[model samples]
Target: MARSSTPFSLHRLAVALVSCGLGLHAAAQSANPSDSPPSSTALPGVVVKGASEAPLSVGGFGDTPIAKLPLQASIVSAERMTDRGLISLAGLTSLDASVGDSYNSAGYVSYLKVRGFDLDNRFNYRRDGLPINAEAAISLSNKGSLEVLKGTSGIQAGTSAPGGLVNLVVKRPTLELTSVTLAVSERGTIDTAMDWSRRFSDGHGNDKAFGLRVNVEAAKLRPELRDADGNRWLLSAAGDWRVSRDTLVEAEVELSRQSQPSQPGFSLLGSTLPDAKSIDPRINLNNQSWSQPVVFEGKTASLRVTHQLNADWKLQAHGAIQRLVNDDRLAYPFGCTASDGTYYASSYCPDGTFDQYDFRSENEHRDTDALDLSAQGKLDIGGMRHDLSTGVLFSRFRSRLQGQAYNFAGTGNIWGTLPTVADPSLTGTNTDRTERSTEFYLRDAVQLSERWQGWLGLRHTRLHRESWQVNAAPGAEQPTRYSQSLTTPWLGASYAIDPQLMAYGSWGEGVQSDVAPNRAEYVNKGRALPALRSKQWEFGLKSGSRSVDWSINYFDIRQAAARDVDAGGGLVERVLDGTQHHRGIEAQADLKWTGGGVVASAMKLRARIEGSSDASLNGLKPANVPETTLKLQAHQNAFLTGLELQAGLVYEGKRMVLPDNSVAIPGWTRLDLGAKYEQNVGRQLLIWRVGVDNVTDRRAWRESPYQYGHAYLYPLANRTWRASVEWVL
Candidate 1:
């Protein structure tokens, strides 16, 4: 394991200083209330307005309201996040029917899935519309909102996962604001955050000249498992300078570090699938004495410039770089057991004894860089208005891994108390890989009439990849290299039936580069395959009103399928053949009420439902994908002048545990409740919130079937409680 270059004491000192500064600023502002900016009553981290009424930057097309777009999208505001205590991407699944956890567990790496497809960290994660590696935990303390664009967005994102795209919009500097928040949760967890922003003008006292914002967060918590502890710290800074009336330059930098003891999920024991309800949800299988914690450190920086060439045209350029390192040690259990719970021949326990375990250690480093340049303008052709955008994107990613393995001859049973074991011997480095891609795209939106619009877009992408092993055997082949290029197109049309209703249909294409599986069983390992292509067709209707907003969409998607084929000599190779098809219908609704009635002081309701199916293999459902999903949330502020009540329910239908449809995992549902109180005292605003998740103390599996034949299960946490207080001046 790598040693820490900077001591934890330094981080604690930094946090203390920031907290003191915020307190002083708050006191100063309270003394001079007239200098304070207007306050917002909206619930923190929550979106109270519908998408059609909210302005957003979609697919880098510049700021446009949802009503004018022909796509399915959703925005989760910072206010909503605070209301639910959602601090990571995994928390998003509770509110979004189209997203779910993918191969993720507590106290470990994080991954997400959108629409039954994996959103890879190296290719699909983005911040401020720029790509970033999200394999590690991401801090949300400095973000304004989370935006999701559903379906194929290759024309805008270039090479990406076909499921969808997610962008984190950074919070900008406010003219005058100083906010501090303190939180406590179950398991003795403590969290603190501070946000401050200031605006500066030229000597002439002109506005819109320069602005700066800084946000800091620190948290410590005890893991659900015994003897495991976790902590994290984050700092972010953003600055903007208006060089002139028509030009603006912006820059941002973020640094974060997180560390936690390894906690491994459970994999299937042979062909005999154990009932999830029969196991203890809090059992820690990797808690041997010799185990080492995992630590992640990351740094990111970005710069952007925007210039208005004229009233009809604008130019924008952006570039970003990221670096991350992970130190991990784990004792992973594998292999299957017989009907009598007797283990078979497996690397985890070759003798199938209850007293032995297999352990492994891995250290890795990852780096990424991305650049984008674009031009957008409005043009009038023959009295028709058109919005056009053209851009070029380039990105590169590299990763290196060193691994070692050891066998503990005598450990413990699956459910028995673990026994101490000696530390594993170190093994040399193993794998190194790099990938790069470049793309150019163009898109245009044309208004045919007052109620009719058409859109067209195209993107050409080039991908390159190479991989090699550091410990190759004699006479091994040289490093593998792969390159490919393809062009994808997008078309859409929208028609307004009335002032409040819109109907739209779209057809688009997406592509993803494929790399050979790294498992030892793969015969043709480390060989890159041709890029996979996916096409989608969608139709939807959106309706808006003063009190209600709703949308219903139906989509069909098809993509190339790759499956593993077992060859001789205990080898397996992945081959692409038939195509996989996924079709689904999704519906969403948001309603708010404000009136004088007893039950209508202030109320908000949100709901989502989805039904999906796999049409590629005789209606066989895909692994880890539920056929149906539903979510409902409500908030009301009529009980008291300063109090609000919130509650929500989430449900997921049965899902397949394997690709062949031989086994299935039962569906589950959870309930969450929260409340908040807001009051003003001496020119300062104070808000207090409390929430409980999984109110029923349900024990269930959260995710499964990440690999083709592996039915690894990720368990959900038990009932957890959270409370927080915030002061703004």
Candidate 2:
């Protein structure tokens, strides 16, 4: 099935591109440039010097400068990503204090946590401002920048996790050609990539006729975990055409595949949490022979069109399709200890043998399609200028899960000798699920006064879901359908104190549909619950200049909690009753100088600090989330020409390991260093880059307690080195 889908996808992509090209050509030949109205697209102006100095797109309302907007946002540029060797979402967690890893490991899916809440893969991930489900590894080679909007973003994304929204900006065609990079890491990993862009013109030298960009990358790596290895491949293409002076069309396609052997992280021994200070970071508990490799294949395609109807109005339309397949096999161990500190897998045994060792395997396939159409313009009402936007969005997603679990006979002790068990056959497989949603939204930003701007927005969303599983008995009850609707609103205002400073406040809400677990232990299993809602209030001050940028903000958010209710006779029902609240203060600063007096010819500094608490739990810090987090980085040009030095530090305060706050994990800090050199040779440029992470080789636990009732510990990687060279032709 997988083999056949690839070719069909490619064929569809070809057809779409050809059709768009023909349509564009026809329109360009018939339309006159002089008769077309002025463009009204509200795109942000690009700043090539650095990402921190640039403005970013703010969803359907178009782009706005960071300091001028009434929100907290951040951008990580391609140059910064390359300089720091940040190849995955996992690396971003260390560089940004506001983001953290939830359940991240090599050869598996990546999950992230923001502001003490989980960022859902189904609704919070985007590519080029369009939703694309990313439940597998994501390649960053073709991305121009990574932009993050913190806090409730329901106004921008109809339905999303309240934690935040992440957007990946795709690279576009440029006049200059870049060098090909060849890189290697200390863990026996090799990477190679090539990037090229070109602009095509007509015989009369009209440059805006067409443009194309292509990027390809391949990598093989031996993970830090023993006996684990993986490989990745990616190819991406983007094209743009000027249909007419007032109209434009763009298309993009990306194909990615990855495979790796499994190496699961460690879980706590029953209800007793072990002292994390005593564990070795390199230990692997699974049987090497029983573990299976995980494989992922994904393809995505998108098309966008924009046209100016008049001098004050512009219309835009976008459509995207994504498909992904994940195949995984794993051997997992579950055990607990007695009061005497004796370990048992199934029950407390005198011999300290593991009671339950299971082999689990699953295959999942997902398909998603999304479309968005919107019109935005400037209007004057009551002598006040207003930026108005209205949009409609439609999204459909389908997923099929086939999984089986087999319980083995053997057991192993957590503190004693480990035993190997044979692999078992599969037990059962079931279930297919589908979700669909449609939303309509309207927004307006009005200049209420000379120094005050007010913003108002609202979204009406309708969600529908369905799922089915084979029942064992004919009379058994099953839930196969669910539907819900919500209307979320946004209100905000910003007061400009001066040209370089602004004070802003906002009130917003987010909504998410709940998915039921397909487990037999629950009496109301597969019963869909009502949509969850979260509300947030924020106030902030922002100041920016050519050489410096700073922001400070305070926020409070509350969300309804979902938990299982014990019915009777070993059955449970899901319910939502309690509330969870998160309150925090965040501050960030960025400074850059060129040819300064007391510094090198080029110098840059970036820092962020945050403190948060769970207001619903008597100000206690949430599990797996630190109360205080800090990140600092610096870069400077060395005395030698074309030489640059870079360094960074990350510190995380102690955090609770359980909901009851019975145990805690110690705080830890890490340091990183790197250097890069670029030299021009005639018509070609050569560059060399080297970096080392965890320079002190410190061993610490990076994460704990991603799942309830289970305290899992994820250890940090040891000192690692990376080197790369690039040659431009």
The number of the candidate with the highest lDDT is: 2
Model 1, 1-729: lDDT tens digits are 443423223334334533443343344334533455656863444344555677657565566677667887778899888988987877778887877777776677667767777777777778888888887878888989998777777786667777788888899887888999999987788999999999998666677588999999999977456546789999999999988889999999999988877556665554455666776776776676666677888898999999999999999999999988877666655454444666543212322224344555456789999999989999999888989998888999898766555455354545636575655655333667898888898989889999999989999988788877654465452467888898989999999876667779999999877777665788877677776788998877766544455666667778777767668888888877556666666666665556210100110111111122223343455677776677777888857898888888888776766666676778898899998899888899999999998899887877775463346676667788999999998
Write the residue-wise lDDT of candidate 2 on 296-324 in tens digits: 89999999999999999999999999999
Q: Candidate 1, which segments miss by more than 4 Å at Cα?
A: 1-50, 267-277, 336-363, 403-412, 420-423, 473-478, 518-525, 567-571, 595-618
Stretches of candidate 2 off by over 4 Å are 1-53, 270-278, 336-362, 412-419, 422-424, 470-477, 595-621
CA lDDT of 672 in candidate 2?
91
User: What value of lDDT does candidate 1 attain over all alpha carbons?
Assistant: 0.73
Q: What's the CA RMSD of model 1 in angstroms?
A: 12.2
- Report the number of backbone clashes for model 1: 11
